[model samples]
Target: MADTAFHSARQRYADLGVDVDAALSRLAGISISLHCWQGDDVTGFESSSQSLGGGIAVTGSYPGKARNPAELREDLDKALSLIPGSHRLNLHASYGEFGGVKVDRDQIDVSHFAGWIDWARSRRMGLDFNPTFFSHPLAADGFTIAHSDDGIRGFWVRHGQICRKIGAAMGAALGSPTVTNVWIPDGYKDTPVDRLAPRRRLEDSLDRIFAEPLSPAHNLDAVEPKLFGLGSESYVVGSHEFYLGYAIRRGKLMCLDAGHYHPTETIADKLTSVLMSVDRVLLHVSRGVRWDSDHVVTLNEELLAISHELVRNDLLGRVHIGMDYFDASINRVAAWVIGARNVLKSLLIALLEPTERLRQVELNRDLTARLAILEECKSLPWGAVWDEYCRRQSTPVGQSWLDEVRAYEQLVLSKR
Candidate 1:
């Protein structure tokens, strides 16, 4: 059918049964956050305000394949040009392999790490502390604190404290803009395994997060959860979905990852329905089958369905989307672009929908129809799509990793 013919057809359907404009307008209000290289330092992002985030290294901790602090900060500086008004930064930190003992975080890069903190401090940006613990290492391959000996538990706690201390200080200096996002690749294997010790260890460590010395600076702790890696072994990974009512009872926040669910889970609608019940939400989203592998991928039909559900449900507040990816084989920036564009487009799909009846049952049909609506609204610029999509986000956390490039040292001995 011709454009006119198509419009007429849509009108004919509406003339009999649907209220397209009302539905489309209702969905127009939905929005989401997109990650990028930190463009500049601009913390103070309010979840209610719908903020954005930027980062350099999300998967790797060390400097070898990762961007040093200075380089990351610089990349963020440039990212700021494109991502102004954004203020959330996911700090690149190191972690141990799955099930394996978390590495000597002390041995990891320090100067750049601290530099990123200092940058956040100076620029007044919020830092989503994400220490990298790739699953590729011996420690990550199905090993976890649960299976470790008492001695290993001691070692892990000590390391956790050090990272927490730094994290608290950064949060305090930045005030209300701290986001300590912790996602451990911890779980069990198919075989029978010890569980008590790891459960105790993780529980004990988590309690410390809310303990005394409140770090008034870093009071926000977004415990993010994912399934594919360790959920196979451990039943209690992050427990955001499992422990929402419990965490609320404890006065802590709950972080939910959109991509962490199996395909059967209607995450978006559930999130919208549940957003009000939690203390806070730290969003970890990506394009995937929901039942299969979940690194960042281009947001496709399956992904959009949930995203649109996220829109209709109104869960953009108290939520920040993360690009949870780990592909050592690809250029990091390529990964970044893929994540960014997908998020932006997902939002457009949501907006283009007839805002009225946003239930998924109708969204698929409406989205296909709305593209024509957008194109036909002749005076509107294509850029309107971008504006409609970049959901409200937290403040921007951009920094200059440039100045700290040459800095390096052993954090272990420094403690001495």
Candidate 2:
């Protein structure tokens, strides 16, 4: 019955000049990098006790949060098994395994992440990295890489330098380029008297951090921007304009996090414009409720629009997609599965869009026809095709995945 439904849906799409099989094929190739912090509520396995700060907070006291690297990996394995496509793991410098020894952010080396590399290698998955700029004593004032103190700023610069090398090493070992992104929480709680000095220091710090040239195949660098956060409500140093101009001038990937903009603004529209100046982009797909709350992603209109822009403009090759949400209110592993599956679902729907036909209508000044086709596509049988995709991938075909998660919770998470 499922096969029959898919076949009927395939023909329905075929009539509209859309290729179902091709869409599925392309989706299979796209990998969304899942953040590891979601599993443990951002409490990394560091010997030093650093409270979660830096203008961001994780809510909910969900039970069974992974306590250590082993448990985190175990939880990640279960979540990965449930998700439908191949994906990469995004790691923070703070997550490095330090065998009962204290390894500060600046002192972190690839040796610290050797276990992670082997783990990723065994799973045949690539790794992406971020320099942890928060939750440390040095970053307590909500400033890193842009601190007024030279020593504090240099410490973060060294951290960034070492992180890029670690990212490059992971990429070279795994035969995939690792995108090492930099996002700082530097800003003022109250409006600063002089904003110009901090930005100048930040630019200089970034220049020194990225001074060493590395192969793009091994490691790609990206700079992320934000609108505001808890502590830095008045001012944020790394605004979108700052990073956009820097990315353009430095020839690096610009990371446009979905939740890093105003509630009314969406990163979907920024894709085409950013791509004109930068060669590549790194997207942190997230959902923000009024602020950067980091809610789990769902099949929302903004998500659909993002996928549509990627597919319509044919920008998949140039854009590296990654999930960036942490909702610990529900089951932690389930949050991962839900957000990842929805991201893939949005991409699949966009893939099934008859973009060229709509483009032809719009180019020919047929606005009515264009709008009609767009509205008509909403009622298309995309769900049947999604089920077929799940079946073909040997993943659970729908809400059946929820059952597996429930079983895991009862058997595994409950004990933890």
Could you estimate the TM-score for every candidate?
0.61, 0.99
Supply candidate 2's per-residue lDDT for 177.
99
Cα lDDT, model 2, residue 69: 90
Candidate number of the best TM-score: 2
lDDT tens readout by residue for model 2, 1-416: 99899999999999999999999999999999999999988889886465798876899988888888988999999999989878999999999999989878888889989989999999999999999998888898999999999999999999999999999999999999999999999998898899889999999999999999999999999999999988988899999999999999999999999998889999999999999999999999999898664899999999999999999999999999998888778999999999999999999999999998999999999999999999999999999999999988989988998998889889988897
TM-score of 2: 0.99
- State the lDDT of candidate 1 residue by residue for 97-122, as single tens digits: 11232335434333335656677667
- Cα error, residue 191 of model 1, in Å, equals 3.1
Q: Relative to the true structure, how large is the alpha-carbon lDDT of every model? A: 0.47, 0.93
lDDT of 1 at 36: 31
